[model samples]
Target: IATRGLVDLPIDVLIRIAVRLPRVEAVARLACTCRDLHSPAFFEAAMRERTARRGGEVPLPSGRRRRETMVQALCRGERRDRFQRQNKIAAGDYHSVFVSEEGRLMTCGTHSFRDNPQPILGHSELDDEDLQVIGGDSVLVVPRPVAGLADVRVRTVATGYAHTLAVSEAGAVYSFGLGESGGLGHGNEADQHTPRVIESLRGVRAVAASGGLNHSLVLSAAGEVYSFGAGDRGQIGHDPESLFVPSRDRQEVTERLQLTPRVIDSLQGVRVVAVAAGAYHSLLLSEAQHVYSLGGGGATRRSSSRGRTSRFTGPQWTPQINEALRKVNVVAVSGGLGYSLVLSEQRHVYAFGNGSHGELGNGRDHSSTLYEFTSDGLQQINARIRAQQRALATTDAFGRHGYEVFRHSMTLADEAVPRLIESLGGVRVVGISAGGSMQTGGTGHSLVLSDEGEVYSFGCNGYGELGRNFDNESEELPTSVPHVVETLRGTRVVEIAAGGASSLAATATGAAYGWGRSECTGLREQVGERKSATPLRFADLELAHG
Candidate 1:
């Protein structure tokens, strides 16, 4: 293998062929060719005799971890063997990147440059460019797809902080690039990298678009949910500078700037499936499994004896329904930058806001919001002593099923409600996701997703995204990556999503997996800063391999 000699092997087979070689930056340039294997005590006695002959673990040989998980399984098999390429890509450090698949739109990267990745300017499948104009370019840029919106087929895509939302397949809705506070609804504050069409929505089956350093959220498909750019901390419930809108019939609409699309009248029939956007606040998920919140009314509650005060602020124009979730049915909702999470369908999980770095798995501290009264505080005190001895007869009789919650975070200050992530006890949680990976030494974390797709990480692995390989260090809490994904262990994982730092999983045989921090998840040139990831498969699905 490499001309027979090369140090005549057997240093525990050269540390299992040097931990699957090639990386460690081409083996530190192949140990600087000589000087007795580049000093440093022969590379610390070959990692202390290969961590004392693997007791610390380093086996490979599952055909070399399937050829090093084939570089993210050949980039998800060439993005599902091309036909249109682009499976999914996300970014928010302003490095943009909102790519979706097959029936596309595209943008390149450049939140603030880090050496070449440029490919913006698109959207024009023709018809006199009816709706094109993607984005400008930034480093290495590579997005490219949007040409007149290729019949606007799209499946799902969301991005805020410069506007961009697409969700068509009859569920029609579209917008492109910046619209100031109106976030591109087209009525005023101008800016449109070209898609358009939000004709006040039509039937809207399912959609989610989010934002907060300004304001934005768009949830529809009957369950109603909507908001438009910057509402100060009212997060768009209205009145901080007018972009005011709130009327799925709940009607509030004022101060002017809704540029378009309105409906959230306190979520009428409720239906909403999912919607998350924070930096101020906004989260919604209800199919009966309720969870409705609206922008940082001063970040919510906190008295620990008056160290913080908004007097547990309230009234961001209204839409608060969290009363510690009545009976728990909500099924999936997420948000970041300030904190929020809810996933229930008996997979129970609830976290109010700001648990600092613990991201609300409830390790305590760091301001909590106003949804307290945690997870049925002992099943609501045992359903009020079984309804005062009438012996409670089935409201699902204290129903408690496969509880689960994937990932979360909130504390930047102010929290009054929401908290029930009891440190993941009983482990049935399906999936929760968060982001902002890579910042080692300074600590800046967030990443969670489980349903056995396993991958729990706590804030800022610096860049290793808490994959735990020690790229620097920063994990204030939440760290479960005990490696049982033996290529997705017993299968399951229906879906999962995360960003800011990166994490993803999908199964039930559709196959998809991800690691952390690197161009968010285009795999920064195939696994460069994945601090602790192991489930790197990325997709090969036709459903067979267990």
Candidate 2:
């Protein structure tokens, strides 16, 4: 079949078939093999999925040509599997989650040592109660049920170090696991074994939940925000010294409860759209499309020649709006251990906080304490860097700006100032997530999802985070997955997140999938000793869309 001439399939039919093949590289090969396959019809199908409105008139495609464009793009791009309609992922350290459009959730990676790892509802349908068990060193998957979660039905879920929280159709909050520092919102010191409602909050419509090493945050539907858990280093956006702490007596038990979810005083009027938590920091995307940060405030007051600038750096007990994003509208937000990623509706991506392993997706190799780079514009900068080899200039101790020769190119270190990532350009990115310090193959890399549901990975792939099928090969730039995701070639993905060393993607249909480090891949049995290069579809995920 490889050498055969075009199979005489109808162009639209052929385009549909092309979109289903596992990976964009396969589509490219198809186009290369047959002249008829290269027709405009095929190209149109590939491109349509990436777009929402033609002529900005409606949400659906305008005609057959537009549909063909969507199909052809899937064949032409490097990450064709991501553009397909049947795949989604949910990732984290030691464990990952996958929610399918069918309404089922599948998990893999590290299992809790206290109990054997199994699908959250694989043994039986989930009842109203939640479950808890000790965590493990490797990845484990957990797929809980929403049988009686609430009237609204569970729309999303979030996990923390030892806790889990979910949002319902009625806009209420349900949480379980370690309640230390009020992570469970029980209003007192108590670990929850079942789903419990957070009574303090009402009249909510949407919620964004996030967890840290031991802390957590919940952004309410009304744009108000609440936080709890270990406040050490102010992970809860409250004074660490004021929150609960262990007593000097060995027998004493600290409640570690916040008692109630409090509205971040300064953020009250600013409606929040999204929230992300790291080991000790948190980021919130506001209704205004602005990014705000809290906890782990550091010395980010760098005096640039343009102005005396002060930005969020280290431990903070209060929320502060990201000054750099004040002028831009944020469409998406994601993070790993200590960094954050913001994708603007305009297709611009800005990374801040940490960049130790290049999780920031910037092309630098330093730690950024503040706004560092605009990633979406990387293509232009890489082009310029290729044209010139001029050394980076420096300024004096007085903070005066001047040009001087210095060191190497920026890789993925955290930037005190926003530095434009000059590698990913022209390509429209819809989602992005960060993983841990594990450098599987690349020097530094980040996983990104496109508007068409396609996935692209850059930075490090030493553990197959790049989905390249190798653990020793690391890249310094975004590398599109060459093949279509065989399991989910026609699914639509809504968002993606990375945890510890694995990755997770959620579909508009509610399905999810995972890949990467075994302990964090959310699987029961390890795939082998090697990190997973391609995403594995968990059988239990088929239940979500049901």
Off by over 4 Å in 2: 1-89, 98-111, 114-152, 188-190, 202-206, 239-242, 248-259, 297-314, 366-412, 437-445, 459-462, 471-492, 507-511, 524-530, 543-546
- Once model 1 is optimally superposed onto the true structure by TM-score, how far is the C-alpha of residue 219 displaced, in angstroms? 18
Candidate 2, 377: how far from true, in Å?
38
lDDT of 2 by residue, 1-546 (tens): 455336666677776776566655666687778676666567555445323221111111321123444443322222212321222344444445444354333444433344543322222333223232223332334554333342335556676655566665456777665565566666764776556777876666544577665567786645567876655445566655566655545533232335567666666456555677765567776544556676552212121324433443334567766676666546666655545667765666766644544555565442222223366444544454344321111211000122111111233344554434445566577666655432221123466666677776654444565555543423322342222334444667666666655566656554556665555653423434545666765554553443
TM-score of each: 0.31, 0.62
Report the C-alpha lDDT of model 1 over 203-313, residue by residue, as the tens digit.
Answer: 555445655434567765444677766554455565544445433454332323455656656555455546777555676655433456765522333223223322444
Please give the distance, in angstroms, between residue 341's alpha carbon in candidate 2 and its true position after superposition. 0.7
Candidate 1's displacement at residue 127, Å, is: 24
- Output the TM-score of candidate 1: 0.31
User: Which candidate leads the pack in lDDT?
Assistant: 2
